[model samples]
Target: MKTLYLDAFSGASGDMFIGALLDLGVDIAQLRTELQKLPVHGYTLTADRVAKSAIYGTSFDVVLDHGEKDHGFIEHHHAHGAGDHQAHHGRHLHEIVDLITASDLSATVKRHAIAIFNDIGAAESRVHNVPLAEVHFHEVGALDSIVDIVGSCICLDLLHVDRVKCSTIADGSGFIEVAHGKMPVPVPAVAQMLSDRAIPVQQHPEVHTELLTPTGLGIIKEFVTEFGPLDAQSAVQQVGYGFGKRETGQFNALRAMILTTSQSQKQTAVGHDQVTLLETNLDDQTAEGLSFAQEQLLAAGALDVYFTPIQMKKNRPGVQLSVLVPPVDRDRFVTLMLKDTTAKGVRYTTFERTVMQRRFETVTYQGLPIRLKVATYQDIRRVTPEFEDCKVAAQKLDVSLETVMAAATALAR
Candidate 1:
């Protein structure tokens, strides 16, 4: 797929995100024209070539009419403290929603922008222990922040990125002064935003200031689909560096790259991935216990759990329990199997498996909506009606399950 991978080794900010996209070949003139759709004013968007630690990148800034500007990095050397803006205009969640909703931006852009703002509002509300509606945004409410958030969305639309992945964000140590006094490096708002979404983060002791801002976290939370290193199989199409205004031991820039993976290159319907196969033979386990254990394993996120009839040593008819689990959850499933079943040990093997691309389509059959699971591999297509839906239709229509399934499958075809 067309993927955007963000190497947030230096951390992220809204302006940094926009700058990176601009460097990735997002048209600056087009971005400026799109930003004009918003009702707000008094800010000039500027993207300039800048150098951080001797590495050149784009530095995006929002310069307000009052001569106050927004910086992507938070350091004591900068003007209005951390997240503090001299022209800071506080806005409520509803007010921002109304502003975005009334704008001439596309529905997708508006939805994404408003959703990011809502998440920021929720995080701030939770941090201050106030209701979401009553939470007044300080730094994020500024006109510059609004542009940063909306402009990031606009750039994403321009790039037509199918997926967004990020690395573990590198925050800094030590405290920074904010409107609520000196908070931790991440500050309460940034911490709350990451914690609420379970986003991965780390602290860099060498840099003692805020690197990840609330605007950056909100944007990441809204757009990023996965977090990890880039896939080795993917080809790097382009690379862009957006510099932050911090001078650290390392380069203060967020590296964004465009990647094209095999998943997008092939027209075939099959996809391949690695999965763990967990197996354990249980001879002393009771049928009832095994049933309960199977249910628990499935509930605990095992892809599949099945029991096989097998003959153990001494001609004992034992049950072979096999569990298919995502590689990440293999250890958890193994522990559960050892605890819940009579098996003293569990064995796991990683297997690379190929599977058809699956999608669902809902069709009306006899006034009943039936969902058909369609699996495609190469030119082969398999259509099967969901059992529950077919069962409901069979009961209501006074027909056999097979009849209902056949009709639904035909409609799907």
Candidate 2:
């Protein structure tokens, strides 16, 4: 499966998104052909090879003569025109959805396009204090945004991309002039969208402009699954550059690339997770406190927590608290250790672990619930009875714990 990585270095815009895919090798002619499936008309979809800040990239544009706003038109930058100046009326969120759903586009393309529009509608509804069904999309509902969004989706479908990832967005800081008058750079809808989606934004102290657009953010938040820096492992097949309508001192472009599965991602398909080991030595805490810390860490999602007897400075006996936790849960687990243990310092290291796929099932043995943990690895499998369950069953049935365990084990087999 091919994976697409979106580098939101210049932030994201509908135009930039389409341009990047075009540069990544999506045929512009074919893209335009596919977009013809949409029922809406009176707009032109164009992609041209352009240079911005001395870097060449595909610049995509959707042009219309009638609309409340003309988006993707940037000044102080140079690019060739690829769209016709056409006359078209602006649309509402529901109208756009109807147009897409009514189109001959594939089911996936129509679904994704409407979903992206819905995100924008939800944010606009919240920011403007209007019902979602009644929200009027001023700029996003324009012909340009519509084509850019739907066209972008069709391009992705053509590319046959299986996964989408992006970097921490460089959301420009400052103010921008909009139909609602001068507003913050992120704008109310963009801010609300970013806040609602929980997408990470990178702040640059020098740049002051609206780098990331509301339409751009909504598209990414809907489809892009992972967010962070580059994936050092995946081998790059091709790099596509999408240009934005800005004149920042640096090259203002979105660098997207296609990648093959990395070794780690391949392992993850078989029930493995990247983990971080957090370790700290506690010399002053009482034994009971150490015991409590282990219990807390385990309950808080640590894969495993254990204590090792050790000799610290001055040959004083100490216990090393070690915790294994998934990378996503590292911070929470680390915070837990710090708050629960007497150690003033903690350290962690990341590694990969092959965890056998496992699940639990309840079985009635002697009218008591006996939990069986069934674990599998390829053709190998193991079924083990829960010790706690067996002990409870023994107490309730007036039998030895060993006898209860044997019965549960026999039933599991």
Candidate 3:
């Protein structure tokens, strides 16, 4: 198993992330070839060594050709009237999408890049009250942003990590200026992008400035799977620094760590597991209501949800609702269950389970084909239905949910 750990001690920015990856040895030539796919009239990728506090590091820069508007705009945008005027060479979200689709990159790479942009666009849209397509990306729509995004995707592809995990961002306090003008720290756009992801900004004396920008926030918002304190035992293969422009009392840099693990562990084989299983029994709820609650819990990011028939005290009938969630999400998920269910108290346990490599095969039940994911840990095979597919099949065939799930489970074996 392989993993990438992001340490946003100094915070993250679009360019800093790209520079760190480039410094980490991703092929710049290949990245440039892909960037050319965007329909920008003219542009060039430049990589060079830059110094931060006497530490020489690689800095990635984008030089774009503005054609006629180059003169006035360059003069207007530059700090002083030294260079030619520059054009608003910034691109629209649609243009970025077109560039991504037109690039001759692998399908996986393209999908990843597109998904990243979608995440950013969704955030910008939500904040501005505009449609995603109509949203004009501010800092992230620029040439540098496009390069950062495409380049980050390429770097991830090169590393070929199975999963990416992040730690709670140490987003510093204070306000920062942007295209929309100066706003509160951790700008609204960034807040919206991280609506679902957990990146708590803790107060640290050594930290200041808006360390996490919307672009960088959007990247993690879409790709990260889990968030918490870094596990000290995780094996680290390499560590790279993504530097931001802020200088706080503490060293500021986004630490990117590549993890080393066996291939089987990457998928589902678990050598050691410590997971929280939350359970509650309710006898007064209908099967349909339990089903709806389960759906909502999973959608809220619970790892798994299930129901078990049980005989309560005095032989009372009840359904035990169990939800498995990552430690970070436990509080939120538990609150959701409490609000949605009639259970007065929920019981939880931390247990260990050995996991193994398991594969699933497509099977047909009642003329509907379904795919099942089989997870094996310590020779115990746990099979589960592809519920979304089962739901679809049940609706199409006009069959009960149980009938579809049973058929799908049987075929999976």
Which structure among the candidates has the greatest TM-score?
1
Alpha-carbon TM-score of each model against the true structure: 0.62, 0.61, 0.57
Which is the better candidate, 2 or 3, if ranked by TM-score?
A: 2
Note the clash tally of each candidate: 0, 0, 15
Give a tens-digit lDDT track for model 3, residues 164-209.
Answer: 7887777777665555466776777777876765566554544556
RMSD of each: 17.0, 19.2, 15.9
Query: What would the per-residue lDDT of candidate 2 be over residues 240-309, giving only the tens digit for each residue?
Result: 8999888766678889998875222222225776879999998999988988987767644466788899
Candidate 1 lDDT tens digits, 85-164: 54256566788889999989999999999999888777777777777765566566778889999999999999987569
What count of clashes does model 2 give? 0
Candidate number achieving the greatest lDDT relative to the actual structure: 1
Poorest stretch of ten by lDDT in candidate 2: 71-80
lDDT of each: 0.83, 0.77, 0.69
